[model samples]
Target: MADEKRRPRPAAQYGPTAALVARNVERLRKTRNLTIYSLSAELGKAGRPITPSAIAKIEKMQRQVNVDDLLALAVVFGVSPAALLLPLEDSPRHTAEITGAGAVPADSAWAWASNKRPLKFPPGEQRTAEMEYALASLPPNAREARQHPAGRAIEAAYEDVTRVIVRAAWSVEGDEHEFIDALDQARASLERTLAELGRLAVEHEELVRLRDGVPREGSD
Candidate 1:
């Protein structure tokens, strides 16, 4: 090994955030059951060939990560750049499904339905996972809707209502007694729409609070 490659200095030489990122990198690397040599090889495959000893120094917080190192680490871990930089608990998570479900606290009872990707999962599964992650990154109430500069929330609500209207009309066309069925469908849709609106309200309030740095009612 070259003299420069030797663990150059004590960990205290690096700032606290660098040490935190090092710990997170090590944790994520271990979660994939990768050894230091394997991780270095993976990095090399991604066009940045780092040595195992250097990786050891990184994991041990004996060396600070540069921009290139951070990007390479993100690729090796299969996560976004923010994942490497942010605290684990605050990182964006894949918690939503295709159903446009409500958000759950990341630490709550919700666990990813399929953490273990089968060795030979069909291509569809890969696409589905990617789609789900994209949805999960959005605010839950707006998962299927694109945001506009204005009236985005209204548009989402309109879509929900339109779906309900179509379903309700179909229910009544089948039979005379099916008016009750139409009413039931309408009621269900109304409930779902209300829930979405409630979510939208909360999200809007939170955004306002963040922008103004002011507290709103019942917000902690």
Candidate 2:
């Protein structure tokens, strides 16, 4: 029995998300004018190679994509992993069939997949404690920082600080003037950001109190 040849297992059936991923893979490959052979080569260069035959099987939905393959494909295609899981069409009227969520508006689906919004929230609805908690629970890098002015300010402050540090590290003795200018600019940027954050802190405290049904200070 040990010497006998092993038989191949049947292909596993995948859900709606897998089907969407497969479709996106095919569409992106064709859009970029890459053949299966070339895509396989690109994947190999990415260090997570999928054979040409397996690529065809994936496009045909004959094979399921594992997480590594998903990431490799995203790298080769120059798109975020979420992009490969979203529908190609992004019209608000069109719907994307998510496996667990049923049919969601294409725009909303994309927004949810990109972490820009919660999946269950309706448009124009006021933020609730639950929604706020959900957003807060996400990792810093995954939060929709670009959507809020304060968050963007924080990001700008971080970038300015990083730039100053990099400039300082690469500066020579004669580059003191340039380094000093960069340090001054970064300090100014941080001060502005600090002021913005102070204002936001007050606003955030009020929001938290409101969500928790606590009355404002000096309320009757």
Candidate 3:
């Protein structure tokens, strides 16, 4: 197993503010051998102009870190935000490889052939739900009814569709392509649904802006 670093203090130890977020950022970087210079350079190339000096300052807790910076760092490290947060005791050790195996690829194939399966997302169902939510948020002029109704009916309809996606995905879970396909299906469907919803919402949000001299609080 890889050497596990000492976990940091939980936010409860510091309260609702920044807490140990910076420390977690630094720790994760060190754990992955991602030097401040390398990470910041990567961030810069990715269109967020960040300097190594700035990265160092942020890690030292001398500079404030915003959500965008934190998010960029997390993505670079390929870790969940929660992992960089929420202090834990006796957290299980993480190891990326199974040792004592023959060729790694052969071992991977063997593992894939084993009982475990991949989980898939239901493209149709997810889109339906997002669309329904979007439709409900539309203004009276946008929908036949004055106010958009809750998309419960669509959600219920998509339940079975989602189930199929999940079941199918479970059949190929460990394989990267299959797993990614499952994720992509969910993401793509929902995003397209959201785009449609956003267009409709924009219309309603716009009308509210026009109706009242002062824009509504929820106005886009």
Best by TM-score: 2
Q: Mind giving the per-residue lDDT tens digits that candidate 3 earns over 56-141?
A: 87766667667787677768778766445433221122211222222223222222223111111256575454445445554555
Ranking, TM-score, top scorer first: 2, 1, 3
- Model 2 C-alpha lDDT per residue in residues 16-98, reported as the tens digit of each score: 99998899999999988999999999999999989999999999999999999999999999999987898887655589998
Extract clashing residue pairs from model 1. Answer: none
Count backbone clashes in candidate 3.
Answer: 8
Residue-level lDDT of model 1, residues 1-220, one tens digit each, is 4665666545456654576578878989899999999999999999998899999998888777899989989888998775665445511233221122344333221223222111122566964663455465556554445333223445434445544555556566674455455556556656666677788788898898889989776868
lDDT of model number 3: 0.54
Error (Å) of candidate 3 at residue 121 is 30
Model 1, runs deviating above 4 Å: 1-12, 91-220
Please say which candidate is ahead in lDDT: 1 or 2.
2
- lDDT of each model, Cα atoms only? 0.62, 0.81, 0.54
Error of 3 at 165 (Å): 29
Q: C-alpha displacement of 180 in model 1, angstroms?
A: 29
Q: Name the better of 1 and 3 by TM-score.
A: 1
